[model samples]
Target: MDVKVQKNLLCLSREAAEFGPFDAILELEGEPDALWFYREHVSRGVPCIWRGAVAHWPAVSKWSNDYLRETVGSKEVSVAITPNGYADAVREDLNRFVMPHDQLMPVSQLLDVIERKEDFPGICYLQRQNSNFMEDFAELWKDTDLDIAWASKAFGAQPDAVNLWIGDERAVTSMHKDHYENLYCVVRGEKHFILLPPTDRPLIPHMKYASARYQLDLASREFSVVDEKDHGVIPWIPLDPQKPDLNRWPQYRHAHPLRCTLKAGDMLFLPSMWYHHVSQSQGAIAVNYWYDMAFDMRYAYFQCMDAITDTVAEGNCCAVGDHDIEDEQELSTGKT
Candidate 1:
């Protein structure tokens, strides 16, 4: 879990081994030369262990659950009250308003109604109209801003909006990807985020799964089925990227998967287009926020036109994106 170099360590490569993956290692353990390289580079990607992250704030500590629940459940209001005042809850909501409705909004009418707070006399049933909760929230990340990291303020102008998220064991966002960049801060309790890269759009074959191809039938409030095959009986095949489990999806080894671990004060940077999955560790948690605009996101642009959410496991296949993608390729390749 340790990334920094300890003293008496000979040759930086020996120290960097702890991080795994020999693709491109950066051992900055007390190395001024290595640290200097990152500062000068553009589009930097570095995973630093828990260094100096902050604790939860009164507002966040006081009511993060209340905020996410209120926002996700409410059919209206992109901005919410954060005990402090009116503020943008997420940049994606704003982007939803600005982006063409057909391109992003889950519901078209939702956007038509989202005029600036100045004009629309608070919609009767909306959160702002009926609730006493504060409308503004401060960004979660105020201290750990790295120069190599993307300029969140420039892209998102996310000075006050929340970029970080925290929740209890109950916090669950049914498989879905956000339109904005994310820096996860794990403080307390446990949260699990399941993620798939953008290229692997097939994984979101079900409503239970995240996908771009599946269109929402607002009138029925139901998902339109894309494939005729009863996924319950047969499993889809997928290419594995990480340590392939042949007993599971043998093909998984072929697929390049990216995983991460974030402990207390541990922050994770998700560059645009990278599919992510998160699981809250069991413990106390805290995090800051930052957001960026204009990403060539994989979802909105590339639809999940085919079924791909199927997963493999203890002998069973579920239709709603939970099928075992039996990697036939694994057997042929001698991986299984």
Candidate 2:
């Protein structure tokens, strides 16, 4: 379609309306697709995601040469990829964090390992603050294929202990949003992301802020975010962030979902407090930058803010880095 690029423009009410429902993007393929695009042979409809992204994926691959031009099965298409299977397979090879072997190993020498992957395994984590990241964060800025200079403008202060996720199609996360404004970007394959505005967040089921703590305890692998807990599955419950269950906490339902997708070279401007969910379609891979309010909030000056910060970033890890503030103060302080 007609993808328009605007500079220094404010999203008018109509232009900003894309946030209410989910959206999808397609075709922007590139080189990496060659390495990761294995012949699935299974022809199926797309997926049940709200929005999907597919930018810069490789059009061809060395391995794909064998099955080039071959339709999936009896049909004209080519692969039979099971989304759940794909998600499981991708989680196999990714390092929890792939922080450049170049900084530690020089680029030319390690190019092979970087270019050789059957599928993309995703990476996710929580880390402490690094001051150097603000001034001239080389990796995030110098290397990003997108407008890092423009993208970096949206940080208040960098967060100390914030959640970070990166990966390929195999790195599919369940559709969920936390009490945080997210910065989602696609460096590799196209990244499909969906978000819920604060008004819709209550529809997302949540647990006591303290009980789930990253809800899916990665340490134990108890990834039950919604519903109630059964023996092991943690029982999936639909938590409406806007209208919470009084029986449970009686104060949930306030959150909403406002979602979208980001192709390679694309960036998302998430206001604090917005809830989001994402899935990578086909050969898409991506990463995200999440900021908690304890973060530096100066970037508010750039993102079309008519007044002060309207959406406060709040959720599970609300005041993780605030050494001086007590838990009580953490809950009380939100975007003003």
Candidate 3:
């Protein structure tokens, strides 16, 4: 099939129009039953918001600055530091996909950086995802459940990792997808997410960039991109959803994006493989459960789609770092 036809079928505008305003997103009033939740949302890979789902968790009420300082203050934790707050994102100027420089700092010091009480050179974000909650912050585990009951039931497995996120307002998570079904719960402040469905993979351009990491010189307080010679080229999406350069990535105009904000006590069910970019209110604190996704038929289909996308990209003579192809026409006039 032609690319246009494929794009149209992928977007499914006729069905979306029929759904009307609901096409924006689905919101759940409260926690859902396992069977119904799996059948309606999880099975179909649909995203939803569960308002006040974890409102009753003790952390939501007791996790004030003083409380956290008194509890886990002196504990040294891993913190991702970046000068531009764009950790694990494409550094266009350097032509590389750069990772943040991770440093070990006391929780109290990290909080001070986030609160602007300490004048740190780079943005500090405590975003270690290696089950940090169950490890470094184990003392605070009494405040919240180890696992989300309904979500664990729906996924038929416990979370592979539970991560705690505390970051400055400038710390931004670049557009990326994960292989795990994610349940992100905001415990303090708010988080804004820009989500794009996986079907838009073709429209969303991907380029291979050299892998690098930001390294800060402690004495100079300056950051430098250090290339990881062994890591090779990393495929990443270069477009920034917040300020998309439509002229360069004009095909992205055909993609549709959903925007949502999750306040404290709210939980977001972000399905596996859904591309998302996230930013947060200053001192935003969140916990996310990563459940391993089943490598079932859905995953198989996505792999097939991904292979087809690569084939199309190759046929259009799209280079490694540049995706724009003049010979390729616009597919759909949906939304940017």
lDDT of 1 by residue, 260-330 (tens): 45454444545444444444432234443445435443343443222222222112442211122243334
TM-score for each of the candidates: 0.38, 0.35, 0.90
Candidate 1 stretches greater than 4 Å from native: 1-50, 55-156, 163-166, 189-196, 202-253, 282-284, 288-290, 296-336
What is the C-alpha local distance difference test score of each model? 0.31, 0.30, 0.84
Root-mean-square deviation (CA) per prediction: 15.0, 17.6, 4.3
| Total clashes in model 3, counting residue pairs 3 or more apart in sequence or in different chains | 0
Candidate 3 lDDT, 1-336, residue by residue in tens: 445444544455334434433358788887799999888878878899989999999999999988999999999999999999988999998899999999999999998888889878999888888999998888899999999998888888899999999986899999999999999999999999999877767668888999999999989989998999899999999999999987777767767788999999999999899899999998899999999988899899888877877777767743222233222324335432
**lDDT of residue 270 for candidate 2:** 52
lDDT of 2: 0.30
Better of 1 and 3 by TM-score: 3
In terms of TM-score, which candidate is stronger, 1 or 2?
Answer: 1
Clashing pairs in 3: none
Weakest 10 consecutive residues, lDDT, candidate 3?
319-328
lDDT for residue 25 in candidate 1, whole number 0-100? 21
Model 1 scores worst on lDDT over the 10 consecutive residues at 1-10
